[model samples]
Target chain A: MTATLTPAPEKAPRRARASSGASRRRDSGPLERQQSRLFWPFVAPALLVYGLLFLAPIAYAAWTSLYRWDGMGEMEWQGLKNYWILWNDPNFASSIVNTLKILVIGGVITFLCSFLLTLVLREMRAKLFARSVLFFPNLVNAMVFGAVAGFLFSPDGPVNAVLGWVGVETPPKWLGTDNVFTLIMATLIWTATGYYTTIIMAAVDQIPPYLYEAAELEGASAWQRLRHVTIPLAWDVITVCAVLWTVSSVKVFELILLFGGSNAAEPPMQTWTTAVYVYASVFPTGSVPKLGLASAAALVSLVMVGLFTVLLRRLMRRDPIRY
Target chain B: MRGPKIVAAGVMAALALAACGGSPSENGSAEGGGKGEFTYWSMWRADEPQAKVIKAAIDRFQAETGTKVKVEWQGRDIKVKIGPAIAAGKAPDLWDNAADVVSTTVVTGQAADLSSVFDSQVPGEGKKVSELIDTKLVDTLPKDPSGSTKWLVPYELISTGWFYNAADKDLAEQPKTWDELIKLCDALKAKDKPCLASDGELMWENFLTLDLLLVRDNGAGTLAKIFEDKSGAGWDAPGVLESAKRMEQLVKGGYLIKGYDASKYPAQQTNWAQGKAAFLSNGSWVAAEVSTLVGPDWKMGALQIPPTKGGNTEVNVSLIGFSVPKKAENPEPAKRFISYFIKKDNLEKIATEAKNITPRADIPAPAELADVQKQLSSNPVRPVLDNLPREYNQKVLFPAFLEMWHGKISAQEFVAKAKEAHVQYWKTAG
Candidate 1:
């Protein structure tokens, strides 16, 4: 199973390592020798399940993508025509653009807020409380946040009420049609930052306080210590967080969908992500349900995730700094 | 590990090779005849009186025929559950559903033609089932242009209208003309209140208003042309523009509830129920949607869209019908049950107890919907929103209407843009 489905990232550096490390002699341990004998049966059940459940379906999708099929009917073979339709579809294009905006723009804002919070939270008296409060959003459903945002940002909602009480009377339209997508992004960043901050907080705690002390003794400012000692130490966790954020951003559907609290069966297409696009195409609300189009979109999304993950991993690769 | 992975890869590769040949999906159904326990999937919720009456009928059927007919009260998510089962060829024997059965179930070919059941007599009425129902409904379920089969059997009939609170000893302010309607809105505006509390987020509700506008300007037939016309050239006709101007006036004239576009579904309806707004444009079933909120003595009344300057009142009528799935396990019993259930006495129970309008001509509409029913009976009936193609309604058309509501585009711009979009759609369609 691993031979064909071995993730491209795993294969990539392995090929380069095998080629470059030709002179390095390896010694096999007794446990490694013992493990090789048991590997087949040990992996057999899991491999069977994964292949049948995960990879087989993906392969089936790849096959089905070349056809024009309504789920309960005959599939007319249309090799690459379905992909052409997807490319031409303004909704699909917007979904892709919306997805990237969320991934990159939302990612930047989230990391910025999370890093700042992590830094301030380290010295705060009620650090645990602050962290927990920040962490609470991830535990709550995104739809709940969406609903709350709808209530709080209505024309005469509390946000506007507070703004009116202050000097600035003209509060922006938070739930307006154009503003909703931006609101959804802001919500995503607001919710996601807390989770990442908690993670980075844990990673920061793992660093020996003595390093900070040493840097301080060497006439390093707080910023200097954070840059040289704190960040370098937390680099591995941050990279992991980056990959996690990227995947999560793509998977976002419910929050954007329920944003501004639409009672309509289908939300406006402006806020749709790739996942929503796949769902809307296959199990459509308005148009004919095209499983072929859905399958093709899914394959495209998978390829996107794969490409981004490879790029991220390659860029984040560094020498392990043993503390 | 390598074995399963390689096998998986090889299997997919083999499938890829086979993909070029175009394997046709086989159509098969277990609908030959009836045997064993029969299952039904009703879209009605269990708490509703429709469910109660259906259950009583089912009990009686089981008692008489000694056939176990299991009824499942599937909620609004009935379509969601039905979709996979339809694909897997495990469809239920009977489904009582669809606001528009033609485009949804009929074209998809999931619903079997039920013309054979029309002969079954209403149990005690001594009348044929077909004779009791509205022929418009009988004529409405789209059939194959080449075939004589009817795809759906019409059940309860629902009329669309405006809902208002009558708690203050009845509304003496029923507007019967466009001038009277505008005067009504202006009066409410003078009182610093919104007369019409409609949810613009859901385009169907908004379209109901637009439909009345279209039908009112010219006639039902003219509006139907706009819906049927593929090129969108007919959209710029006088009647449509008049309706768009009316919509523009409604939106730009400060008559709608503030933040109506931003409000969620049912919020506006709820606002009407709470007496926050003066009126809500909705269907006959509006009472049931907000049944829990209204008090025992709560008075709910609906008014048909008043006559336009030149056109007569055209009421939006819909047939809430049942269709036998092609893959039904027990078509015979399902047919018998539908016949038994549609009997005058049984259907009258739906009216008296459940507060619904039956397609059976003898049954009076529930008192709450008397005015709406009166209007529906008086006018030329059309399928809600002229039965516009669902694709255009949901994607292109609804969005255009939404943009206009959002104040992003003007009414003239809406028409021009829609015409352009329609032209683009035809090019794509070709």
Candidate 2:
């Protein structure tokens, strides 16, 4: 190892001393040549794998969307017909609406709760423990929440029992067709707010304590210090968090599926998101699956995520505060 | 840098191994066709009573033939787990599922042709396997619409309709007609109890109510025609609107137990068993599902809602059957097991141990379901709405029917929406 390494350094000096004009003008090191030779070998395997598993499958789904197929049998060319059907489908349209509700409405409520909690938790003892408790739901499988929601909200469940104890005889039906989606959105926000708060708090902690001290010295007040010093420094992270929530919210399925009951055939159409729509289109109980429509719905969801991500980054972009 | 390079190489090796499907998923197959090791995937969970009886049967088969049969209890996730495996051609030698298998396996075609298995006689039955099973189930076994080829060995039949508490001594004898059923439901309502306790979220439970009404008002032929006629005409057949109206009357009259629409399934069943409500619309499986909850001697009875105005006794029946994957390497034993399964004695063991009905005609119905079973048997069997295009019942009829039951739509509106959904489904699924 030493001999080979010595030759590269030694050759560089001798070549520099012996060379005239052209050769001396260009000093190409052996190490640089070695690195160039090894680059593709280092990168090609990961690139090939990513292409096969991710890119190829995505491309195949896109191509498959052009045909009417049942995950089996002959593929009939439907061209734009599947997408046309999706456009006219009230259920699909409603599903997209539900996805947006969870994305935009659920996002707002989750971040609002998170930012409030972060402000208080920063100064509190056992703040780390509270953060862990808040983030615990993410560790459990989401279907557990769905199943628990079913039992908790049942007419004779503990939630109603509490209401009864409070002398409210007629509690609103929490799992009714009208209210189940609202409960789902609420549950998503509660479970998700902790995770983003943890991230935002970490970014806020990275902001210099001196910045807050200076603001306090100038009598900027708590609200103004938060508005100017803390938020600006955390703007870049908040953008990433928005993109993360947008992607995750649209993919919500298990909670909604099990919210009404752990074993209902499917969640009511009133609660469906694009993810649920895609799954039901492909594997609806007792019906012939529509794979082409499933692919189209999936592609639409991908477009939604892509569009939101770009918008989030654009809107949240700022001149970096280097404090 | 060296550490990252090592990690990258490790990941590359892992991906390559995964791409190659490391170590072939070999389920043992017979070498020359005598008896060999094979695998069976059952939908029953390990703790289920059916699992024990099935495992005992497998043990008996293994002891007799020296075959090492691997039994995997997959519960409901059996399909979800083995669906892709079957497509990848790694399905077990013997898997029990049907109908849902059609689009993925029976047609495309991943399932073995079981017509010959049907031809194979049940031991000591003195008839072909087809004759021993309920004729309705045999007829209802889904065939490739493109052509006729039997793909399932019909085994268990669960009769669908309403269940009543035998414990309610004041409960009168079964109604003889649709008007009588309405009278009975309303009479129960007058006494502050509804005639039927239902889980409205389960669309099929409500759809079954419509099916029995349709059958009594229009014979089985109307249903068969309904399947053939994709136009709104099929959904709007002569008696269809009237039956929906009759059902709408019961819904409007508040004859169903209060809060039916909000109740989830099994919760409704459990409530019925608990005697919180008088009657439940469910399948024969209700007895076995809530047997413990109702108490051993508590005794429950089933009654199919009677026909309308001296109408015929046509009733709905569903079949639970077995099928083999085309990729199964040991069809010989799988075929043998299918035959072995139908012997009146082995079936009786399943009935006695699992406490569920088997398809053999010779066996009397289990005590809980005996009344409904007799009603189901008195006439020729017909498929339940489950046999309809799943989209028709699930997407079209279900939502529409549920809305009407919720009193959100009129029976006339349900008919219109069902027709529109039918048109849309035919246009796309075609």
- Candidate that would win on DockQ: 1
For model 1 chain A, where is the 10-residue window of minimal lDDT? A1-10
The C-alpha RMSD of each candidate to the native structure, in angstroms, is 5.8, 8.5
The local lDDT score (0 to 100) that residue B357 gets in candidate 2 is 70
TM-scores of the models, in the given order? 0.88, 0.86
Query: What C-alpha lDDT, on a 0 to 100 scale, does residue B336 get in candidate 1?
Result: 81
lDDT of 2 by residue, B241-307 (tens): 8888988898898887766666555566777777777777777777777878885556677777676
lDDT of 2 by residue, A1-323 (tens): 23343444666666767775446337757876787789899999999998776666566667767888654345789998889888877778888899889988999999988878877777689988988998887778877777676667767778889999999998886766677789888888888988899999999889888888898899996777778777778877887899888878877876877775334277777788887887777656555557677777787777777788787765665545576
Model 2 chain B: worst 10 consecutive residues (lDDT sum): B1-10
TM-scores for chain A, candidates in order? 0.90, 0.86
- Which regions in candidate 1 have their CA more than 4 angstroms from the true location? A1-35, A167-170, A260-264, B1-36, B144-149, B166-171, B221-224, B292-298, B424-430
True contacts kept of each: 0.12, 0.14
Which pairs clash in model 2?
Answer: A286-B390, B177-B307, B178-B307, B178-B308
lDDT of each: 0.73, 0.72
